[model samples]
Target: MFVHFGLYAVAARHEWVMNREEIEAERYARYADVFDPDLFDAAALARTAKQAGARYVVLTAKHHEGFCLWDTATTDFSAAEALMAMCRELQPHMIVNDRLGIPGDLVTPEQYQPSRPLERDGVPVLWEACQTAPRDAALFAAIGEWMHRHRRAVHGAGPSAFTAPSGVTYTQRGDRLYACLFDWPFGLLHLPDLAGRVRFARLLHDGSELRMREIPQAQQAFNMNPAAPPPGTLTLTLPTRKPEVALPVIELLLWDSP
Candidate 1:
């Protein structure tokens, strides 16, 4: 069974209310404030699926509008946090595609391997390359986050050469600088390139604010070596608990062009 439920249902027009009606994000987000799923019954739905001989169930936890169906620390615009917990208990291996929100390993490399072509009349068949190995839940979430938030920002500046720990990459879109952290940092993350440029910082997953501070030149040298970080290095204090997403993105609202 496949379920498609979201804030768009409140509009009563269609699932594509944001796109079809050309509704702005600010306007569309209002529906979440008033969203009430009074008739939702996860257990009953599971029972019905079982009676219908369904093997598995899938839920669209998040949609194109970025409304989450499950309770998330990342956002308050969720239908119900208990819904996800209930669904998990009912179906341990239940598949969830949060519409680029929380894609739970639906496609694996083994399942989406390259197809071998069969020859006919000694003519080799042309086969397209399978580009699925590198694609994971995190990549989808990143793509969705970019489209939902930073798509309108200019993208010609290319990647930033910011100094930071490994597994971190920076991309600039106008005044907004996105830090894609493949590996979650411990308690603090430092970016020397964004010394005095940052005006605000927040995690894209839940829109939670992060605290930042500038490291003075006096503290730049650890052992009086040339490899020390330069002065004016900005340090961001991250939350102890990481978000539920595969890849966490830090959206920095810059005071000047990055």
Candidate 2:
């Protein structure tokens, strides 16, 4: 909670001048008369904070100078109430500190009164700890380790650069290939560019085997050019309807490398 006001307002310095300059309480109190924060509008501040994408804003009602910005029974000088009224009117969801003699939603208890863990019903994990930079190095390493443990079952070492049909992506390493289907295809699914020694093909998600047909490159009209490599395609027979699950992956075991 930091608001810039009081003697420092006229001094044009930080708000901690009374203590820094060793000014007497009586002499420092003189700024109260001149401390009219005419330009202070909490609604404008709230709007600025919202535009800046700030989750919350804290105002310094009282700095180390011991000046009260809000009208309190203890003092006659306080423009805080007006600013607070503007803030409440503009952003009702704004979080305010308790220093303004106002009740707050969060409580900052002293040591020995630690807060208990919060939970969300039905959801196993509710909270996420967001850390950055040097602190997240270990987190990145852990993710790599997790991926290493599941490497063999994955499509490839990296994602494919070539484009595929909607909801379809394939990974290839040498002769071994794997296909990931985010959406089920009705009837026969064709791969126009797959050219290699055909081998066993099956659905990876479940151990179910799928029948596949290969169009010989020499028989196709596109492979008629002698300079061009034989143009062939692999076709997979698919069910008309999708399975219960959302995405299904298929694995193709090739006998030889292309």
TM-score for candidate 2, please give it: 0.34
Q: Estimate each model's TM-score.
A: 0.39, 0.34
Model 1 over residues 30-145: C-alpha lDDT tens digits? 99898999998889767655544444565668766778777777745345445566778998875543322333323222235333332336754322222322314344445555
Q: Score each candidate by Cα lDDT.
A: 0.65, 0.57
> How well is each residue in 114-155 modelled by candidate 2, as lDDT tens digits?
223223354322222222223243444544443333334452
Which candidate's lDDT is highest? 1
Among these predictions, the greatest TM-score belongs to 1
Give one clash count per candidate, in the order shown: 2, 2
